[model samples]
Target: MDAAARQAVNLNVLRRHDPAISAIVDTSSHVVVYNFDSATETWKKVGIEGTMFLFRKESLNRYGIFVMNRLSTDNHNEELNSEMEIQVMGDYVIYRTLDDKVVGLWIYEASDRARIAKELEKWVVAARQMGAQCLQQSWIQFDVFSRHLAVFIICALAEDLLQSVDTDRVPSSVSATCMLARFRPDPPVSAHWFLKV
Candidate 1:
């Protein structure tokens, strides 16, 4: 599809001023959203294949990420409500939003990407038992705007993924990357690079 046709609503490319970051998943899918990066420019062919989870951002906030071993279900909705900003990092949950809206929360918490893989394995097994559609690696990637980091949450279950995993000890496969060039755009210019994932 054409580049312009691929973009979603909430994302205004004209608003993105960062040179290192490119696009975010303005649309939604069953698994995750996809994002593009320019700095050290990284590109993935997945976009053309119709990937569900992808996003792109201009910056990241490290302090917003929280790695917990287990998320408490006693007040599940309350936590997702109170935390405001959040993302599911493997078996853990990370917070990124400043207000209480269930939309546009750009956050990722796992800093070790490898351990996150292990945790995903566990999550998939459990999710399958519940009759949820699960995705394999290279299928889902989590884009945390606040942290500028993306976690490839492969093999996502077709259920409410945000509510499936534990919030604590979010494994260690997740990593954070900050793209600061996305904040200035008075004069529109071509981005140095564009990512497919």
Candidate 2:
């Protein structure tokens, strides 16, 4: 074969081995990444281990938000993780865990919160595509592993955001009466009611 033809064949083989899309997935509550840099343009891939913080709803509220770079899971977290957030920060600093080396200093801003949350909406599409291409069957058997995970992340954030209403902490002007009516009808249908003050 000619040199040009041989190189073309090698590139095809490499592409076949590479994934069509990359995904951030949760393999049973543990955040795992199956990123194929070759699938995307070199310039698109930042070539760094990006961080995603998965926090339990209760723990996040109780302890406040934190990123566990140490990758530890005690007996407490294993049992209860129904609601969670696969959170990526708007801006963050990467440093070695104390387990390896001391963490470095960084600056964080309040506005960064809104900027990062915008990324969650994009996960739905990426998750669906990830499930379609040739990937480990264990992940794809559900047809779209990341799709379900995407829903979970969205739901987790929604629930956490509504924690105030869930706990009856609304403004006095707005009675907790609407809060009481929540889900009295299982599987709320498409209906809207106008409140005439």
Each prediction's RMSD to truth: 29.1, 22.7
Per model, state how many residue pairs clash: 39, 0
**Best-fitting candidate, measured by lDDT?**
2
lDDT of model 1, residue 166? 60
Report the C-alpha displacement of residue 52, candidate 1, in angstroms.
14
Q: How well is each residue in 20-127 modelled by candidate 1, as lDDT tens digits?
A: 334442222221222223454442222221112223333321111111112221111111112233345453333333342232212233343333333333433443
Candidate 2 residue runs with Cα over 4 Å from true position: 1-66, 69-109, 134-197
Q: Each model's C-alpha lDDT? A: 0.28, 0.32
In model 2, pairs of residues that clash are none
